[model samples]
Target: MTHEVTDNRQNDSTLASSAFEHQMFKESTATRTSETEMDIRDRLTIKGGHVEGQEQVFTEGAMSLLELLCKQFASQVPQLLSNRVKKQALIDAGELPNFLPQTRAIRDGDWQIRGIPQDLTDRRVEITGPVERKMIINALNANVKVFMADFEDSLAPSWNKVVEGQINLRDAVRGEIEYTSPETGKHYRLNDSPAVLICRVRGLHLLEKHVEFDASSIPASLFDFALYFYNNYRQLLTKGSGPYFYLPKLESHEEARWWAKVFAFVEDRFCLQPGTIKCTCLIETLPAVFEMEEILYELRSNIVALNCGRWDYIFSYIKTLKNHPDRILPDRQAVTMDKSFLSAYSRLLVKTCHKRGALAMGGMAAFIPAKESEMNREVLEKVRRDKELEARNGHDGTWVAHPGLADTAMGIFNEYIGEDHVNQLHITRDVDAPIHARDLLLPCEGERSEAGMRVNIRIALQYIESWINGNGCVPIYGLMEDAATAEISRTSIWQWIKHEQKLSNGALVTNVLFKEMLVEELANVKLEVGAERFTHGSFTQAAVLLEKITTSDELVDFLTLPGYEMLTGQFG
Candidate 1:
């Protein structure tokens, strides 16, 4: 069956009333500077202002690809993003998301994805991190099946960091990537047989604030994707691999259709086959969960799997259902995969993907092993149980943040999916009572605690502080906290404040209560990190921003949106 790129939501009531337009970003702080590479194209301009290696990555050829991508598909992004607001408005009004009746035929139809590349079949233990040089060398050399070099959640997109990442990835692709630490003089390089490489671009909501087309900021996804694909596709193809990707934060199948169109356009431009550019979409948002089969059906030509981005899923649950007071979540710690809502999501995703003959990858194990042996054992055991749950529930693979946790995750998958099989595709979870909307939307049972609330405030403050200082992935309290997890932390506090939920200690979660805790937490964090580091760090601004968002009348869409505004002004 040949699947075509089509807009199936034309007559839908939830369509965004406004169309995307090209206009200068009023809030963008990027200033244009006269440089040699700046004259490459009149229509395309780089406003990032003089990085060391800007000339190498921003060549005319690369800029042309970025321009072409912006011209073709960037306009569609705003409308899709607007559709998210419209959908949330409906949920806020009264309606909750359910399976699309219009697309029931496609969901019930017999279909499978076109083909899977040989290199992508056995993705049992994948490690994901920022696109730093030493990280690229270390992750690729680690004993895992894949290393997803991320330009999204784990990366703080300073202009220099963004450009340098592309250069690092380019060299890594050619087996020439090397890093010598400035402080320690230790060198790093890729191993002979490195794990397969994949890139995760930023989401649709974010813009590459440093790049402009027709005086408007271009979609960061397009910028990241077009540059990487244009520069690396030929070399990758020659090496028997294709441009594999992990599409993040897709809320609907219409968004998936948009991506399929992009794949088709780029493949045709390069004279490659339809399935030459493959991707795995993360079912991170709550709306995407209901549209799993439709999403697979939309991108069947190029999609290989669907991953459970559990942290963001929880965050979305709070955001999408913010108006529904009855569904207010308790503690972030209490909302585990064993909860009804998360369990239903996992089982339904496994069933949907396996039914389509695609892989179902599990969520991340974000524990950073402690230095103490007993504490480290507890961390490994926690990760082991998590991976075992996914493996037994028919997940083909799982994610790990640290190299130390890969062995434990790999062992769990190996126990279920032994030497013979590449994945757990044979374990199709077909049961009598199929997973339904209520099952996926069931209210989680847990207790709200004063201690949990305090922890959330501290984590969010520290993570946001690190993020603005050009570090996105932070290890705080022994866990690798990324934007997704940090999002949950802050949003949970906002939700508690919004609903005035009562904690187990008999204290009401009022704005006054939150402010009290924020002050206490800031002092505690300052004491823990030392006065020298705390005084020089971005903690003050982080606290101020945290207080504003948590105490405001409405919850902010994303902390990164505001955090990015701060980051641009300080970009070096």
Candidate 2:
């Protein structure tokens, strides 16, 4: 049966409104610097000032692939994002998201994603971290089924970092990665064996200003994915782990369709088998949640798994429904996977994937076992229970934020899926996630406490400082935080303030109160990190930047958007 296409809302509304972004980013087929065997060079436009490692990053062939991908698909990014805004507008106007009337046919279409690769068949434990060399080495060596070397949320994309990350990934793929820790004087290298590697590029909404295609900045997703694939596809294939990916933040099946096309073209270009590339789509947004079957149907041939990105999913829930007074979330701590809405989403994910002959992966166990303290031990126990829930509910695997928690998650999966078996095809229990779209809008209830406010302020300040220092993932309050946690921390405070939310302590959360609390936390963070480090670090600017983004009249979608401009020294 042929599936009917019903993304008319896309064609009629948002796609038509994104002319400005497209006209600005038309692709150029010219040469930059010079072409050389030592380095692939080509013609390109650079709006941002020269990036230190840009030269090595844009080696001729790699840059060529990036240019081509942008030319073909970058024009479509703005519309996808705008579609999100339009849906948000509808939600604000009192219409909540439901399964698309047009796509119901597609959702019920008879199809399944191709079987996962052998190396990925048993992804019982996956570790994720930034693209920095030592972190990449550690993650790959962490004895998990897969290591997602991230160029997106877990990374602050400084020009040097972006290029250097590509180089590091190349080296890691060839088993030549080596790094010596500066502070500890400790050497880092891969273990005798490394986990299967999968790379997560930036979302479609992000832009790479350092490198322009025609006269405008290209989509960072294309830039990151193209560079990695152009440089290392063959190497990965030769090593028996085919080109694998974790596609993040897709809002619609149309976006998924675009990604599927790219995979097909790249496979043809490299003369690899048609389904050589595999992707695991992250259902992190409310809109994407409604389109799960359609998303998998769109990319069925090369898709292997679907993961529940719980934190960002929660943030997306808030962001998409910001204007609904009835939907304002409570404290971040109050929300957990066990909530009816999140649990419903999880069960639906497992049922959707398993029915389609694909793997339904679990969410991140962000609680890191830190310092062996009592609190840390308790968090570890919580992490163990979380993984067990996933295993019991038919999730094929789970993710851990730290290597220390790997064994804990791994043991749970082994109990259910067998030490030698993965893909969780044996679990045949019927999951009862009979959730409606409104249930996805779980009511936000709990004390908007002064304590919660303090936690937000302190974590945001520390996270931004780390981000400014080029570190995206940091352990704080026993949870492994990357850009997503930091975004949630700040945005929650902003949303709370916008609503003048009353705390459990009876104080109203206002802008005035938030700023006062922020100042105190900034000072506290400075004292905690010591005078010299704080003085030299990006603490002051980070504090200012954090305040500006959070307190503005407009709610920014991703903190990284503004933060990226600051990192590359660019502005509106």
Candidate 3:
């Protein structure tokens, strides 16, 4: 049987208007049913407790049967069950009828197993911060839909910071926060606007070490902390009105289920309604990848969206593919959109989310242009193109490292989302066909040797130089394009920066700033390579070596773009 295509977009307005209507229907039905059941129970009680019975003899077997009948009748009405038991039953059944109160069924369509509104998809920007209060206020003012105050990877390993993060969350929810300017240090109370604040808690794997200061002991203290903060904050926040949380680094669907249970427990203790607290998981780890569908199913109603963790993903890939020398990532440039594995994984993620009727967001393209120059212009252009490609490839949204890049990202989204072929609807006869990533990489003939690395490096440097000079568009060899090429170039530069660069503080080059600093490094490499001579090499060999260096330079330029400045600001 063929399913009807009901335009979800058109139904959104009707759904909003019918919210109160649905509520009335449920309340009326529940009230009338309760009254009828109570009437029957009262009659039963009266009949069971007769005046003769009070005086003396009632048959024990008859009384037992009467009691049994009453119990059976009561059990038939689900509303008679304790809220906890009802909720548990619903969860076990992989449904969330109680949470919605309006939607009778858990599954909406083929894609969405949960009854959550796709309103999360309407939210454009996600602002993250190390400090909860500050980030929350900024996001609210910025009018971004999701504000993630991070306590995990962005924060350091300090007990005080953890306590502070929790306290800030409490304060923000209470609307008692005072925003202070970082530059002027002037403080003011913010009570008017509140964005949907979501906390990125420390990953479960790091809980033991973080709380106990030892890997062996599970951080039981931390669990208490979570319980206390979440319970109190849910109550305080709901006093006015606010959204839920964004859970990061979940390893399995069971973990998500556990979190949902934790949420329910906290909500019940705090007298908050079920589903008041919502969650979205970040698909960062390898385990999380395999369990994506199950996790989404488990958190059906409360789970809103999912994001890819690119850096962590890269780290995982390296660890997993360590045994294969051929798969070694020599430079960050080698890990471009061109990489077969990454592209394939991205496509799978997009398809999976869409299939489940959830928003599939692209990972961070941390291109922030530093300083107002031609290089910055080139960087922005490249970032715009990359974001466009992400949107075109079925991703609802993509991440940007910097706030300055936000406008460009939005603009790219607008330009592409409305285009004919870009947003064209495809009617498929079969629903099981697979979607693949678009072919973005060009064919290149080069030896997969150290010489190939050299060519990549040179290309990355040239791209960076063009970016810094304010060339909005640049041509490499005969290829004419905007910053997408520059971004690929920046990736190559990141590889060299990661391995070869040193900081003034003696810390390793890891952040976005270090990436931007690679332009100069690429130039230096170019000079060094010029002094060397290859006396006897074939045309293919020489071409291959040059391509490697050029690719490297292009990557460096990409990182140095203006869009990356926003990412640096996040860390700073």
Residue 144 CA error for candidate 3 (Å)? Answer: 2.9
Q: What is the C-alpha RMSD of each candidate to the true structure, in Å?
A: 8.3, 7.9, 19.3
lDDT of 3 at 264: 61
Candidate 1 Cα lDDT to native = 0.87
Of the two candidates 2 and 3, the one with more favorable lDDT, higher being better, is 2
Best by lDDT: 1
Backbone clashes in model 2, listed as residue pairs? 31-42, 31-43, 32-42, 32-43, 40-59, 40-60, 41-60
TM-scores for the candidates: 0.93, 0.90, 0.54
Model 3 lowest lDDT segment of ten: 47-56
Residues 246-360, model 1: lDDT tens digits? 9999999999999999999887665455677889999999999999989998898889999999999999999989999888898999999999899999999999998887899
Model 2: per-residue Cα lDDT over 382-411, one tens digit each: 998899888877999889888988888888
Candidate 2 lDDT for residue 126: 96
Candidate 3, residue 480: lDDT: 34
Model 3 residue runs over 4 Å out of place are 1-111, 117-121, 132-136, 181-183, 186-194, 208-243, 268-274, 416-572
For each candidate, the alpha-carbon lDDT, in order, equals 0.87, 0.80, 0.47
Cα deviation of 454, candidate 2, in Å: 0.8
Cα deviation of 241, candidate 3, in Å: 5.1
Which is the winner by lDDT between candidate 1 and candidate 2? 1
